[model samples]
Target chain A: MAGMRLQIIGCHSATPRLLARPSAQVLEIGNSPVLIDCGEGTQMELRRLRLKFTRIEHIFISHLHGDHFFGLPGLISTFRLLGRERPLHIYGPKGIKEAITLLLKLGESWINYPLHFHELEQGTSDTLLEAKGFTVKTFPLKHRVPTQGFLFRELPGLRKLKPEVAESHGISRAYYLKIKQGADAIAADGRTIPNAVLTEPPAATGSYAYCSDTAFDPELPGHIRGVHTLYHEATFLHTEAALAAKTGHSTALEAGKIARAAEVNRLILGHFSSRYNSLDSFRKEAQQEFLNTELAADGKVFDWAEL
Target chain B: MAGMRLQIIGCHSATPRLLARPSAQVLEIGNSPVLIDCGEGTQMELRRLRLKFTRIEHIFISHLHGDHFFGLPGLISTFRLLGRERPLHIYGPKGIKEAITLLLKLGESWINYPLHFHELEQGTSDTLLEAKGFTVKTFPLKHRVPTQGFLFRELPGLRKLKPEVAESHGISRAYYLKIKQGADAIAADGRTIPNAVLTEPPAATGSYAYCSDTAFDPELPGHIRGVHTLYHEATFLHTEAALAAKTGHSTALEAGKIARAAEVNRLILGHFSSRYNSLDSFRKEAQQEFLNTELAADGKVFDWAEL
Candidate 1:
């Protein structure tokens, strides 16, 4: 199986604090890098993590909140300064293109690289990016402003080889690729060997769902059903449920309920409110509803291979 | 001396690095905080330093470069999030207001505090602010864009009272205020006492000049002549003089020459190019021409009292 890793760059809600940062993350699936969000100070976090700048060709922004996409202009300018010539693709809500372009125009600067923007609608879910055996889809999210959640689904891995069975069937090495592709192999002797008999089944497809800055909505589980890993925002504690609802944010308990209802294997809670000094409470609150809960700390990496 | 302290936040040129940051500094003159040229990630540095955010009422922006002004909108939003109601005044170039306003509008967010912008002219030198025994003036700097440098000059301090001299002259205590105001005092016996006899000289007026992203121009010295301390941009070493000139930046040797010609008491070199690792070389090169040269290291504070 190709490795899938999620690197949490910043997950604090509202504003950035001394220890806590705004929302941002990097999802690496099938060796392809995708940036989930670009908050203010996100570039610094990217530099601190020592991630390959050129590898992140695609950036997905959830909304136009200053904390969500304020770093785009700066990051784009930095790329030009670093002499990047590759095209950078941005998938975000409408009005993002105008916002970014306005800032560039005001600065009297233009990026050297080609920037392609894919504006998503708030009413419907749609596939945003498909490349490298991975497909990314955007689903509507309930927030004060127009927001969307991302779902990353990995394609099926190559079939495992049953070497002993293949040799017993006298299948030539040339037919190995066809067997991995789930095709029946034809031997030189004009014999038909079923693909299942020649190779073992492929590994289960790995999928991840990211829902941030959204309120507690029961409809979310249907769109992200049975995701292997889910990252949901827990912007408040259970005691502040009213505040969370008012702000269109999810409490830790609500995030747990959503994750459990979706039947995700592992749930990662992030986008914590700065009011809480300790994150242990968030994990504990989430674990009460969902047994397998993980706290998304800054610079934390969740590697699917290790899991 | 009013205990002027210069706080270096980020001084690296162009993009921010893992350890180094872009250009930003806080000048505490006469116990009043003034922010100069806030670059991206500067607010985090301010929080890391534990500065009193409310004390920074006035901010000066050198130019519209993304690094210098990208942090303004976030900082403003953060102030609002933290429940700041005080007026925040910003002095910058003509397009600063439009640039900042557009970003705020895009986010659909508004600040709670009164934000006042004092846009400076490109070809004019004028006093922007005056209060608390200090006056701030902007002078044009030679850059690729319409950039300006700031000069902070302290007004004359309160006259110092010589107790022994006053007692020797038999000056009444009620006459002290008049004598301290540089007025002659009349004794109860109708004898005139000169103010010089009753009081000693006050401390020298402290001044600081900030020049960044500027080319080495001879005319700069005329505007910043004899300033107590000058912080000039040393973006390159003498070997890369041509590159520095092409980029509208000054080399360490050029900064030293400017400081020497301006007859400034002390020179603090900053806005360094990230290509060079050892800053000691910058100091050494500047000291060759201006002996009182200092390097503007991150988190380094230059206190006039210590000097």
Candidate 2:
């Protein structure tokens, strides 16, 4: 199976400044690009990065904040203007459809392509979306509004068939399916061909979990435990912990603590507050608790296979 | 009185691309900056231009399209984040207030400063706003929605007093007010002094009219007749006249016709369709109809007094 790759589009929180656009990211798995949290200038950023918008098939919106989803309508309209014919699937919380529909009505323009909206509800875990060598699941998160997180796990591959054993036993093409399924075959002379003799070990599977714009909740450890890469929000520093709690956000130290508790191999922290001009403090602060921490910057690409 | 200077911030039509932002402009009249139609990525454009946000006091929105007003919430929040204490007045059609309020509610944030909304109703004209040395009036425009165009006319200045005549007639400071009001002043010597003798002729007042995102409507000529500068929308060329009418927009030829009928000193055309890569065609098309035609490009500054 091909490994998943993550690309950071924008990571700043609240208001956009000269250095950043807003909170948006893209996940590339196989031939498809999955967008996450499209902020106000995501399309421009995509153009700047020279990414193909037509390849983006799925969009996962974390929450309903303007910084997270304000750019969606413009992007959708741009796709129509660009003559996109492919269907776009948007998985987000309720009210997203209404907001987009209202904006389109106000513009007096309708999209030419098909747009599908899947409204996610709370208390659902491991709801499979697609099962093409990987499965995408939505889990609940703690936030001021209704929110959900996503977990993507690669499915185990089938065992390879040993050609020498199969040929020697005169295995027919019809019996190859059973060999690949790890079933022992009985030959015509009553000699048994063991499943281990005919099959090799399957490839290793990897998993990545995305916990976006959520407060520090230890209960997520079980859901996101042992993930290869974990993307979490670090809106503020420890000094602004009170403000973070008040806003239903997380501090850098809190995000580090969650990564440490969840036993995630690699921690990618983003959604930084616009107040802090430099991200050096975020690295220093998060590294105090979690060693393998990486700050999310616009256009930064992360490979899951490397992790 | 100081003349009004218009600054073009964003000037793209239908959909914003990577290089272009959108259709936003700033009218700098004296010390204050009146923002017109803040499209998407406007705050970033303002930052790039290094214009002081504190100077922007009033905002005039042409319509409720996403390309016109999507940047309002971000700019408003940025102002609040920068610790602005002054109030902001936004004047637009009826649905603007609801759109802004709903966006604020969804973000779960409130502005620290006071925000006033002046909803424009249909058929309403001559609504006096700020009266420093000019007057602003909104006249009806023919568009798909309830749209209006704006006219900024410089108020006639006070008559210049001839110091020699005032000294000879023994005019008091209190009588200067009457002289400035074009009234005959009665000196302490019981002699009537003619207003013309005490004052020279005042400078001619200048005016600028903004007709954006409108169809080919000749009725606007009477409302904005003889304006010094007119910024009109030219979304298409003569070849796409049918598309312009169907989309509730105007062609370059139509814009020039409006300018010629209104007898404006100079015509500035913008809001171009994305299909035309080069703007020379629009300039040529408009100039063919009206001699004094200028293309409205991003960051182009036009002075009212110069025209």
Candidate 3:
């Protein structure tokens, strides 16, 4: 993929403030932009980042909490107001459609474009969508309400091409596609050229997993094992472990434990509680268990090249 | 009233922008703060102004448009998150209750405090609420959908007290209350003192009318006649008069004409269209028809003493 970028539009949890926003992020795989967990001020945050939001076609909501999906109605209305004609797809819990359409109906302003809803009710892992080079899967999350975590895994591509080697072996440009797909080429001498000689090995495909609004569930590591990057919610500190369990949230130390168990390459701790004035402690606590850990903030971007 | 002030949280119409927001304002009548509208980013705007929004008990929505009331659910959710226990009274169209409660239901975040909705379905002018010093009334507004204009009129108070004059007339301190209510005082020497000489004239009570998201209606002037300040929507210029009519909006010239016809002390033009780059033209155009005209901008304030 040429351009694989992850931008955090908002990262704070519970309520939005002047500087801290709720959960919202944009994951751009190649040229496709997938919105995840839109919060109340997500649109404003996107505008602040100067994002071309019209290109967004798929929206994956984590849950139906106000801080997670309250911006859906306003964003949908803005898309219609801006004369967007592309089909917009929304994936969330079963009642999301009703919650959105009710407000639109009361306003007497129906969406002009095609709006698709993929309501996920299953309490197990399920494959949601498959694009050209990536696949999206939903795994169950532990929260007060039914929630799901999304996993984006890049599909393996064809082996790397060695054009000069193929040309020197009497292969023409017309057989490049077949040669890359592991086909043998025949020369004028009637000698068979192995496909391995014409192409090099394929690069490793990367995967990203996003887990938010969940407690310290030991079962989470199985669903996102060996992912390249894992963005897990760390809403509180280890000192507030009881409160985090009561609110169905995870502590920074617990998120590190999950990252260690999953064996992910990199761990990004986000969705910090608004109570904390400084975010340095979150990183310090998570690094205790997972050395390769980072913090996610508004407008923070992580390119695939960095991974 | 000691601390009567009006703060414009967001004044632009249609879609919200980085600097320009949709319709939402705060009208502080004495110590009681009343929110005029709740746009997409009103809460953030309030935070920008450093307002203690928890003191607000009443919210008046002009219409059911997304720009008018989309922030209501988030605001209510923020109140609950902040542990607000005061009752929030919302006055709007009949379907507002369903529009708000549905989102809350889907989020599974029921408001902990008492929320009361005063649904308005009347087609004519009627009084909506009567506070200690002011009364809120609604008048019919011609729009694409059911819309109403709000008028806040300060009630007439007791006559001004002249303490020195009353004491010189041999009137006891206990008889001051009756004298201020236009009662004649009977002195201990059996002498009758006229109430007019004991009290000075009461200051003229002020009124403010908010007419937004409505087409040019000639009857609007009659509903808000002789108000001190009139805030009217000027979504378009006279050059786009046809478009303003089609969209059920008013032009700046048309708003000026209404202000002139109503004989209000001052006119405030707001809810401007995003197409206009320079707001100076709006002020110039309105001043041609109405002498005292001002433009409303985000974070602008209008104090009672200035009026």
Model 2: lDDT of residue A109: 62
**Candidate 3 structure quality by residue, lDDT tens digits, B14-44:** 7888888989989887457899989987887
Evaluate candidate 3 by giving its C-alpha RMSD to the native, one decimal: 1.6
Per-prediction share of native contacts kept? 0.66, 0.46, 0.66
Give the Cα error of residue A79 in candidate 1, in Å: 1.6
Cα lDDT for residue B252, candidate 2: 95
- For candidate 1, lDDT tens digit of each residue in A194-265? 887888888767889999889999999999999999999999999999999999999999999999999999
lDDT of 3 by residue, A1-307 (tens): 3346899988999878888888899998746888999988788788889988889999999899888998888899999999999999999998999888888887888999999999999466999999877889999999988999999987777888798887777777888888777788886566888888888866667788999889999999999999989999999999999999999999999999999999999999999998899999999999999999999988899877754
List per-prediction Cα lDDT, in the order shown.
0.88, 0.83, 0.88
Candidate 1 residue B281 Cα shift, in angstroms, is: 2.3
- lDDT for B99 (candidate 1): 76
**Error at B304, model 3, angstroms:** 3.2
Q: Per-residue lDDT for A275 in model 1?
A: 83
Best by DockQ: 3
Window of ten residues with lowest summed lDDT in model 3 chain A: A1-10
Docking quality of model 3: it rates as medium
lDDT (Cα) of model 2? 0.83
